[model samples]
Target: MAEAFERGGQQAWFHDHGHWGVFFHTYDNFQLSGFGEHFDQPRKIHVFIPRDYEVSPDRYSVLYCNDGDDIFFGDGETEQSWQVAEKLSQLYLRDQLKKIIVVAICSGDRHYEYSHIPEDDGGLEEYSRYLAKGLKPFIDENYRTIPHSTVILGASRGGLAAFYTACKHPRQFPQVATLSPSFWLGLDSPSYSMSNLDKAFKIKLQNSALMFALTSTLLEPDLRPKIYLDWGLRDDPGNEYEIRSQCRCMEMIQVLTTEFDYQEDHNLFIVEDPNGSHSINSWGDRLPNILQLFFD
Candidate 1:
């Protein structure tokens, strides 16, 4: 049997495989032209709604994830993904997670879209606006989502974008998860060394905008969003481009804890996986834990 629903420009198909079911939808050619000049391109939005969605009257929480294609399909290069739909089904069946809707936004020019530093072309601001102003409202209006229960999540450069977007619009996205964010983008590092710690720390200190964001959260603790951050200890400096990812992740933790006064395992949780790496497989393995932190 087949059933379907449509809302605004979005459409969903109910797939029942006897034992279980899932609602898959595609928002094809989702345009970002109204948000900013830099975001004139169109992107696809892949949404997953649980099988019981149509019959259940309960509103669901929303998880907006970046790198939509990779989150579901496993980046073609790595042959791995968060396997979000499969994981969600398992958790729902086990009653470990509350019913939640997941939306993954495909990326266009990832570096330009995710970076905080403005390339001569564009930067995080345009992308944040697209999420906060453009895409979010559409989802809210079309789906049965609790207003304050929404969370935004991403990994790597996309992770940086997730945090940055939440920081910019805490009222819109009050909860965020970042998996190994590329926080070293605005700094310069020729090589990694134990000696580079002080230098790297100093460079991050000079990031006035980042400092202000963290400090502002401290100043108004009540309005601060719950945050989840994770980094793999095994994300070694052996990789040339990511040599600073681990160091910067530590710096981010330090600033959030010391400067922002975000308590560990409280409103803020940071997980360091001794065996983790900078790969989707690693992030996928940690998704269950991450979702529990956000939804539980």
Candidate 2:
């Protein structure tokens, strides 16, 4: 269990239990100049390249994950990461999942990068541009990847961005996983925090309507991504927000199944955690399930 450490502007580590290795590289400011002009600064990119990457010369599916820092480093207080590398190693060794490349794109100004509200300066469109145009090209050129099997994943606001990006560009990303998305973003009132308790029911209704409208208007059945969504019942302990979030998730599931006619446990899967909370740990706990659904 060798701990990861930064050296020479990169974080590198090898798992003693498996042959796979994880590397973190920094893309300097304006390095992606020609890719997209929306984001102007540098970004730390985490990549997990399997051991057989060089020996096999086989093309593998790619999972582009958002909130790279949280996924890799974990929260210092809890030491709970997505445990992506370790889990991928185990799954591959067991022949449960194929050897896939993971590209974890670190967040830069998440509030801006992951936002999806059309009226707000969410930078989501720009972020998608960076992924579809810049990052994807770089990875595909540098590593062997299966273009058709690519998947996009993220949690919370990042989840929102992942779904939005997939909807907008189905040809590039055909699979997606969203964990506890903040679908309540645009519906929030100016005094949302103060009135959250009283407005829980109202927020749920609003979120349902908004999700329906967004999905119905933007998503086409023929181009929909293989989607996975999950939310915790106790997401925000003692707060009504979690319930509202769950409601929103349910609404999205309803629309997907009924409107889009996506069959459950087929092209669409939804997991509801009865005792789960909204945190990296919760997401980590469910990562195995998601991987099985998407990659198994």
Clashes of each: 1, 0
For residues 1-296, what per-residue lDDT tens digits would candidate 2 score against the true structure? Answer: 65665443334444444445433333322246664455656677767777766578789888899988777667434566888877776787677887778888877788888876657767787788788887787778766888888989988788888887787677788888988887767765534563454664365432443455346424576777888898888745454555556767787777677766788888888888887776787787888778777766
Measured against the true structure, the TM-scores of the candidates, in listed sequence, are: 0.87, 0.82
Q: Could you say which candidate leads in lDDT?
A: 1
- What is the clash tally of candidate 2? 0
- Index of the highest-TM-score prediction: 1
Pairs clashing in candidate 2?
none
